[model samples]
Structure formats: structure tokens, C-alpha cells
Target: MSGAGSVGNDVDIDIGALFASLRRNWRFILVGALALAALVLLFCLLSTPEYRAETRVLIETRESIFTRPNGETAADRPVLDQEGVKSQVEVLTSADLLKKVGAKLDLAATDEFGKPSLLSRGLIALGLKRDPSQIAGDENMLREMREHLQVYNVPDSRVIVVQFSSEDPALAAKASNAIADEYITLQRAAKLQSNDDATDWLEPEIADLSKRVKESEAKVANYRASSDLLVGQNDSTLATQQLSEISSELSRVRANRAASEAKAASIRRALETGAPLDTLPDVVSSGLMQRLRERQIQLNTDIADLSTSLLDGHPRIKALRSQLADLNQQVRGEGRKILKSFENEASVARLRETELTRELNGMKAQAARAGGKAVELRALEREAAAQRELLQTYLTRYREAASRTDHNYLPVDARVFSRADTPAEPYFPKTLPIVGATFVAGLLLLSIFVLLRELFSGRAMRPIDGVAQAPANEIQMPAADETAQPVPGRAIAEERAAAGTEYPARPPASAETIQQIYDSYTTIGDDVPENPHSVHAIASRLIETGISRGLVVSPEGDDGSAASVHLARELADRKLRSILIDMTGTGAISRTMLDGKTVAGITDLLASEKQFTDVIHSDHYSDAHVMPLGLADPERAMRAIDRLPIIFDALEAAYDFVIVECGPSNAESVKRLTSATTQIILSVVDPDDNAVALSALDLDENGFEDVIILTGAESSTPTPPSGDENPNPRPAL
Candidate 1:
């Protein structure tokens, strides 16, 4: 039982099953394994032995002469990562490398890997030999080398191993050593070839570079010579300096001219306003002019005094005014002379400023032309600079490459760390492994084959699926013993009565066993009917037989109500409308329904007081509609049940199935519904329930198309009453 439940656990493995299978079919495994091992031994003995030779190679990570710390080479070499190491490994096993080894050894001409077998040798002696060269040539030799060659990295080391196999031990060693030596020699040769190639290419490139350098430099010189910029080695031209010097001088000259012009204008303003000649600094600074101002003041004082003492034209006043006039005239003449000199200086300054302006403009024009020429000069210089830099770079590279070609000291990154030796023993024809593997594989296959054969033969017993076969007497048929099902279309009536098709006469199982059976029953019953034919098997039988009405009848037990509910639910789950008519007036469905309460039901329809839709209530257990005997008087419903013919006819026409829950009290209605229905499932509480068994047989005799018994448990076979006494065997309900 534990083993049976483990199948549902899904995580547990059944080791007991494996051991049991092995124990049962030990002979098959032994015989099959022995036979296979003998065959493997025979093959090993006949096959030719192969010797393997190995060579070890170490990849050097030493610093290069030119690339070592602070050496001339600019860019640092990239370090090999895991992928890079793998790439190097690929190079060792490449087809081209194998092809090179094959060509050097001339294995194609020798038919190295195509040695004639015994049969072929005999055929060849009889002048039936094929062309050896045509049979095995360059392509075959290359392929053989590729297939036989194996290169792999030594774990946790910077070394790789190359292995090869051959019939001849010495040949194997020779081939492996040759491959290693060729790989190293190939690397050195490749580098030397690259150096020589670089030298050849660089010679022409350097010449072109040198020519470009000279041409660019010459352009700079020519541009300098053609233009008048006269640019110096200091990056400044003479015209620029001259422009600077002239601009300074012009500024000084203009300042001087402006000073002279300002003085002249001030003197002219003094003369126009007729201001005191002493107002002029030059006039005031004159010794005679200062004396004349004093004399003029003295004369004006006298004139004022005389005019106060005498008449308007007094001699004294006239004399004093004349003196003042003379002094004023001298001062004016001094001021005029000073102003004239200033005018001449201003005129000279104006002429000099004009000359400087013309000279400055000429210098600016020349400087503008120099600026344009300077741009060309700078361009030429840049070209020269770039050419020189490129030439220097190529020269440096070419010199290094030339030195390498001259001194042929090319070192390979990898070398032979260890040379392969000739193998004394054959590496192949491993007799023990071959035989052991054959035996194990053969045993496994034979075990599976035997188990499958026994299973299909209906003899294999697995704890997971229960005892494969029950005894023929315990079950009803030999075939039914293999699977818990009746033989197709051949159910034994006795088995049907004991299992389900017929009602039980007695309780054969204990309470727990009956509960287990009910649990399994309800388990399958819960599935919504995605497959209608399976869930509605009973209803389907009736429909196939062109009948739509069915009855679940129990005369001795009350289990008919439950059976009827199950049948109607099954039919409803299949998307078929089913009405379970409880004509027994038990209200059993009402009591069992989660929220159900009985009310006046089917009797109302018979009395014409209610329609079928109004009185019908749906059952919580299933989608099936229930027409319970309602709150109406029980006597009325019992009497109105005589109208069941019309009611049953209407239900049959309206629904896919109508399951009538019948009791002994409603036996007449049962008979009428049964006659209308093509199917009748006789349900009993226990297999030993005597009354329903007798009623089931009577119903069958009375022409019910199907009288299926649903027994509650297994029971003993009971004797029926003798012949004519039981001719009409409808037990009193």
C-alpha cells in the first residue's frame, strides 16, 4: 500500500521494484551478458592493436628584446586570455598544420593508414588488388593525420600534449615528434618571412615618404621667396615689425601735431575776442608786454582822475589816454606776432600728420598681403612636419625589420618542452573495458526486455498498480482479474451484481472498506463531464436505445435517492438537463441540499396549480433540477402521483434524462416511469439486501431495457425460492 501511494508522491523512487525485477529475470541477464561479452572478446582479439606516441609542448611567455621594459616598441603586446589560449590550441589542430605534416612525411605514397587487411592481402595475391595510391592518397593521408592527431592542454599548466596513434610504434613516435618540430619551425619561419616582407615594402614606402618631405619643405621655401613678408626663423616677418614701428611713430607725430594745432586755435580765439594781450601766456611772459600793461593801468588811473577834475576834453586826460593807447598797440602787436608763429607751427604739424597717415596706410596694405602669404607658409610648414614625422616612423620600423632579417635569430612563442618517445605497448585493444561494458549494456537491455514481456503477458506484478491479477474465483472472469474492469461487452451477471451493475444482497465489506469504495466513487464522480459518454454511461445507453427516461429504484433500502441524485448529476454535468423526480415523497434531496427546504413541488404541476418551471428547484449537488414533494399534504402528493404518466412524459420531452427516485410506496409510479424509461439502475444499500434484488429481477422480467445494479458491498450468493412459487417474483415492497 505504501508502494502504491508512492506513485502519487511523485518524488519517491521504487528501488524495491528494480531489485525484484532483477531477481526474477536473473537468468536472462546472466545469459545475455555472457553472450555479449563473448562477442566483444572475439572482436577485440581480431582487431589490430594501435600504439600511441605523445609529445609535450610549452608556450613561452618570456619578454621580447624590443618589447621589454622601456624598449623601443610603443604599443604593449596583448596578453593571452582563456579564449586566446583556446585559439592557440585551435591553431595546433588546424587542418593546414596536419596537412603540412602529412606532406612532409609523404604518408600518401606509403599508404600509411590504409594497410591491407588479411582478406584484402589474399585478394591482392590473386591479382584482384585495387590501386593503393588511388585508394589512399593526399586527401586520405591528411584526413588520417587529422583524425589520429589529438592536442590538449595539460591541466593547470602552460603546456599542451600532442598524441598520435599508428600500428607501428616507431612510426607513431616519428609522426608526433615531426608535428611538434614542424610547429615550432613554422612559427620561426613565419616571423622571418614577415620581416623580409616588411623590408621589401618599407624600402619603397620610405623613398616616397622622403620625397614628400623634401617637396613639402621646398614649398615652404618657395612661398617665402615669392612673397615680400620676409618672415624670419622666429615666426615673425619684417613687414609686421615695420608696421609696428611706423604705427608707433605715426602716433607720436599725431600727438605733436594735435598740440601745435590746439595752441594755434587758442591764440586765434584770444585775438577774435579782443581779450587782454596779457591773457596770452607768451604775451605775459614778454618783459616789455608786462611793463606796457602796468603803464596802461597807470594811464587809465590818471585819465579817470583828470576827467573828474577837468572838462571832457582836458589836456591831462588826453595825454594819459594817448599813453594807454600806445601801450595797448604794442601789446596787440606782440600777441599778433605770437599767434602768427603758432599758425605756422599748426600748418607744419598738419602737413607732417598727412605724410605719416599716407605712410601708415602703405605699411598696412603691405602687412595685409603678408598675412595672406603667411597662411600659405604655415600650410607648407604643416605638410613638411607631417611628412617628416611619418618618414621618421617608417624609418624606425624599417630599421628594426631589416635588423631582424639580417640576424636570423627568430624565436617561437612555443617550443618542444618534451619530445615524444616510441611506445613499447599498444594503447588500444583494451580487452577488459570492452568486455565489461558489453556485459553491463547487455544486462540492462535484457532486463528491460524481460520486464516488458512479462508485463504484456499479464504476469508482471507491480506494487504501484496493485496485484496485477486477482484469482479467477475471487473476480468473475480471468480477464477481469488482470484489470479492475469487466471484459469488453461481456460482463458476467454475478460479477455485475457484486461490483455495481446489480444491487447488493449483503454487506461483504467492513465500514472502512465501504467508505474507501465510496471515496473512490465520489472521486471519479466529481470530475465535470468533459467526456459525456463516460460520465453519462447509463444515460447514454438509454439515449442510444432511443429512450430518455430512467429510474433509480430501491425496494428494500433507501439508497435509491442517492443513486438517483448521482445519475441525474452525471447527466447534468454532461451539459444535459436532468430532472430527478422524487416521487417517494421522502424529501431526501431537500434534507441533503446545503440550503434546501422542502416545499410543494411536483404535486402542484399535477394539480395544474403550478407550471413545471415554477415548482422545479435546482439541486446544490448538481445542475439537475429537482421536483421535490413540497409543503403540500403528503397524502395529496401521493394521490396526485397517479398523474405521473403525464408528468414523466413532459419531463422526458423537455430534458435529456429524467431520473425517478422510487420507493415501495411509489412502486406503481416507478413501474409507469420504468416502462417509459429505457434504463433502470437498481440501487441497494447492501449486497445482502434481499428485497431490491428480487425487485430488480422482476423489473428485468417485466421488460426494462437495462436493469443495472449498484451494490454497496460484496455479499454471499442467496438461494431463490423454488419455481412456480416465485414465478411472479415482485417482492412485497
Candidate 2:
């Protein structure tokens, strides 16, 4: 039952435990809070604030009316084109427009500190800003301006917003409005300048190009007149005639040269003896050579026929031989004639060749001259062509410019849709929001710090409850005093009567039996039963129970000296014989229990100054006696209890129950007296006092038979009905 109660009690929680845990780790929580606050303050101090201003612009596009061929106006034209509105919105934020805005605003100027006024100081510190000259060269002023400005089309709408921010509120608002106005003005000025410049530049260019075109045409006419070269009729006839004449002359010269070369070669060959005449084979087999050979063969055949008919000695044969000889001679003569003809032809060829050479040279010289003239004319023609092309280009440009100027028509969707207006309030580091943001940021940092500290610390613990209501397994009754009730007369009388009839009453049992008897009487049970060892009780039919004895033991040396009054009252209610002995040389316990009654105590008894019995007081409990430590010198109380053995022996013999209330365990006197006690029960209230008690127990080294821990008594009503009446109800110590 006790074990189950303990298990149930173990699950209970104590609120005090949580308080105790916090108390133990107060430093952690406090330090965390302070550090968090400090970090919050630091962040709040370091951060900067930003604000923005925005202006909205509406884009509108109008459709133009187109006249039909018959001069009828087109109907059902769309008012605003979505694509045109989108394109305008895009153009408004374009770099070209923004550049003009920057120029109009004179954004390149610096402040008194020589720092660029339009650029952020933070950007400059971070080395993001370039030199002003470099910025100008790259036309980067617009880029820098755009960094501070933002343009966005409102979703599902044709409205656009131009937002800008600056450290200075007024400057931000001014710049925003200025950008819008300058963009519109720049568009107008750019269009006008472009058109005017186009017209101004094209007029002289077109006139000069026209003059160049006329000059080119005159050059072309002059080239035609100077050349006078006919295409086919005249030149072709003349060239054909010349070619025929040259061809005839060349053929004649070639034949003559061939014959002359052949004659000269033969003569040279004859002069130079043994020289081989290596004539061409084709020449030998030519038709002309074949005809000549055929004629010679026919003549020879006639001569041979004539020779066959005539005798060798006949005049006719002689004449034929002579004729044959003559023919050979004639052939030789003809050969010579041919050679002479070749020589004459050679002479003619030489002369003809010389004349033809002169003529050909003349023709070549004329051709060279013509070619040079053609080259010059071609150069002039190229120049004229280039001039004509340039003229055409310039004339076209000039015409376009004149046309545009005359028409004076703006491009579609070019007109202004919205104008900049002055803002009512400046935009910049907003005061309320900045301060509020700082506070919020600080709090956030503080919370983080606290959370981190909680995560890292390790001092939290669980709680306990219901200790006061938990059942007790051991009983602790105070020492008896004068107020204690005596056992009932009938109960005592019955016990005596049964004892007389049976086994005679003998000397009392040992302290162990006394302890047992105390346990039984205090335990709740049925009425007293008869002693089986007493025969007379059965014969007389009288139920008699043996009288129970109990000991009201105090702490080893504490007795009940300091707590004697309370102990006496508690003992009286329990109907126990309780005696309080102040073994120390102090009469405090005796005086307190007896209500200031003067009592001779241990001091007087030990010195033989007063009898031991004379110091006892019995008013506080029915069967209880109080003996003070006596009014001895403080030095005697400090003396060792081993020196006072007689006093302990006398008290043990005189009382059925002895309650020795000694001094604190630290006193040399108490340690010595602890050895004389059979059991020890320690009274304690303060937790630290328990430590002292444990220390004293350790010092003894010899373990006591019993050690009971007691809480200091407090004056209160009897235990409430629902509370445990006997927390440790086994027996009193």
C-alpha cells in the first residue's frame, strides 16, 4: 500500500519547483534580456530610412480619318489604340527622353561640397559613382537619373507611374515633376530641330548636286563628239577592206620568202660541201611537188618509148638522146629558172615586208592613241556617273524634306497626353514610418536574441506536487508531558486481575518490547484481547490484555529541549508517558515546558548541589517529567558528555521513558551523549538544518538503530478531514 501511494505521489507536480528552477538560473534570463535590448539599440542606430514619391501619366491614342478615293470619309474608326498607348508609355521612360530631361534639369552640377548633388552619398561611398567627365562622355547622366526613378504601367490599365526617391523630400518631388515636363518639351524641340535642320542642310546640297548632274551630262556629250566611233556600218567596211589588202600582201610575201629561202639554202648547201638538205617532208609530198614529179615521169616515159623504137646508133635515137639530154638540160634550166624566180620573189618579199612593217606600226600607233583617249573618256564618265548618283540621292532627300516641311503633319500618336503638375507634399525619409520601422526592427532583433539565449541555456527543470498529502510509512510521536491521558482504570484493573490468576507479574521487558507495545496500541484495531499465557483470565471469564509500553525517543542528543513545550502537548494527546531531559547545562527546555517554573536540572545534579529528583517537573503531561540542563556556566555545557555518565545512568533507571534533549550536535557534549542512546530522531525545519543533522550523523560513524526526521511543529487547527491524519503512523520515535 505504501509503495503504491509513493508511485502515485511521484506523478504529482510542485509549483515551487518551477520557482526554484528560475531562482537557480535567474542570471541567464536577465543577461539575455539586457543583451537583446543592447543589440536592438545598435541596429536602430545604424540603419537608414527611405521614402518614395510617384506621379501618374495617362496615355491616349486617337485614330485618324481616311478619305476614300471618291472623297468620302471613313467611318467606325477606333478611338484609342492599345499598342499606341503602350508604345508611348515605353517612350516616356526611354533613355533618349530621360537624357533630355537630365540636360534640362542640369543634373551634372555639384553641391557646395563638390559632391554630385543628384547622386546618392552612399553610392559615392561605395565607389559606384564615376567621374563627372566620364559620365558626360558616355551620356550616363540619364542612366544615373533613371536609377533614382522608376516607371511602371499600371496593370490592366493604360496609366503609367513615374516614381522617384531622394534623401531630400522636396528635391525628390521637384525632380519627378521636372522629368515629366522635360520629356514632353524635349520631344517637341527634337522634332522641330530635326525637321528644320533637314530642310536647311538639303537646299544647298540639292542645288550643287543638280549642277553636278548637268556637268556630268555635258561630259557625256563631249565624250561622244570627240570619239566619233561608229558602231558597225562604217568601221566594219573599212576594217574589212584593210584586212583583205593585208591578207593578199601577206600571202604574196610569204610565197616569195619561201622560194627565196629555198634558193639561198640550196646555194649555201652547195657552197658548204657535204651539208645535208633537210627539207620539210610535207613540202616534198605537197600537191604542187606531186604534179611536177608526175610531169617529169610522163616526159621520161615518152623518151623511153622513143628510145625503144630507135637504135642507139640511129640519128633518131641520137636525136632522142640528144632531146633527152636537152630535156635534162631543160629541167636543169627550169630548176635554175625556179631558183631565179625565188630570188626575185625574195627581193619583193623583203621590200613588201619593210613596207608592211611601216604600215602596221602606223596602225598600232593610231590604236594606242585611240585607247588613251578612251581611258580619259572613261574616267570622265565614271566621275559623271558618281556625280549623278550623288545628285540623285541629295535631290531625293531635299524633296522629302520639302515635302515634310510643306505638309507640316505630325507623326501619328506624337501629341502630349498628360502634363506634369506640382505635388502637394514632398517625398523622402518619412519621419513617422522611419521611427516606427526602427522600433519594429529593434524589437525583432531583441526577440531573436532572446530566442537564441533560450535555445543555448541549460538550467530548466521539472516540477513536483502533493508531498504534504503523501502517505507516511513511519510514525513519529512527541515525548509525553503532564497533559497526556493515563490508561483507563478498568483496562489496567482487568490486566492485573488476569495476571494474578495466571503467570505472576515480573520485571518489565526490554526497550525493544516497549517499542513493539507502543506500535500496537497506537495502531487502530479491535478492543484489547486476553493474554493467552494468563490461565485465570480464561477460568474467571475476564478478558485482560497485557499493558503496552512505548518509548518517546528524541533525536540522539536533542531530546526535546528547544521543542519541549510542543512535544509535551502532543504526547498528552497520545496518552503516552513522556519525559524530557535537558542534558546540556541549559534550563531553557525545562523552563519552557513548565511555563517558567524554576527547576533544578542536570547542572545541579551533577555537582551534587541539588538532588536529581528535585529538578523534575510534571505539569505539562500526565505521565511526563521535565528536567532542565540547569543554570551552569556556559563552559560546562561545552564540556564532553562522556564526563557526565552518571547523569545518563540515573535518568535511564528513574523513568519508564527518557527524552534526553541535548544541545546541538556540534557541541562536544552532544556527541558523547549520542553513544548512550538506543535510537535517534532528528528535528528539522530549515533544509540547511537537515544538512547539519546529516553531518552530525556522519561524524558518529557508529549507526544509530533508528533515525527519524521531524518537521518543526506549528500552531494550526487539527488536520482537515480530507488530509492524512497519520502521515508516518507506524510508531513514535
Against the unseen true structure, what C-alpha lDDT does each candidate score?
0.70, 0.53
**Whole-model lDDT, candidate 2?**
0.53
> Tens-digit lDDT track for model 1 on 1-733?
2244434533332446545777888987999899999999999999889999999988765447654433534245555666665666787887777778877777765545545557666887788976444653656667667777888887676687999998888889999999888888777888788878888999999999999999899888888888865765466898888888888987887787777778767777887898766776766887877887888888888777778779868777777777788888887887778778777877787887788889889989998988998988898889899999999989988887776677775667787878989999998899999899999999889988876776565444444444356767788632323542221113335556677676558755565665665566566655534332222455556557866776677675344445556566656756888887776636554434424465657767776677777788877655778888665666655676567777787777888877777754334445665554456667665557677667766776666645666542221212223332334332111
Which portions of model 2 show Cα errors greater than 4 Å? 1-148, 151-196, 216-292, 298-327, 356-385, 396-733
Alpha-carbon TM-score of each model against the true structure? 0.44, 0.29
Best by lDDT: 1
Highest TM-score: which candidate?
Answer: 1
TM-score result, candidate 2: 0.29
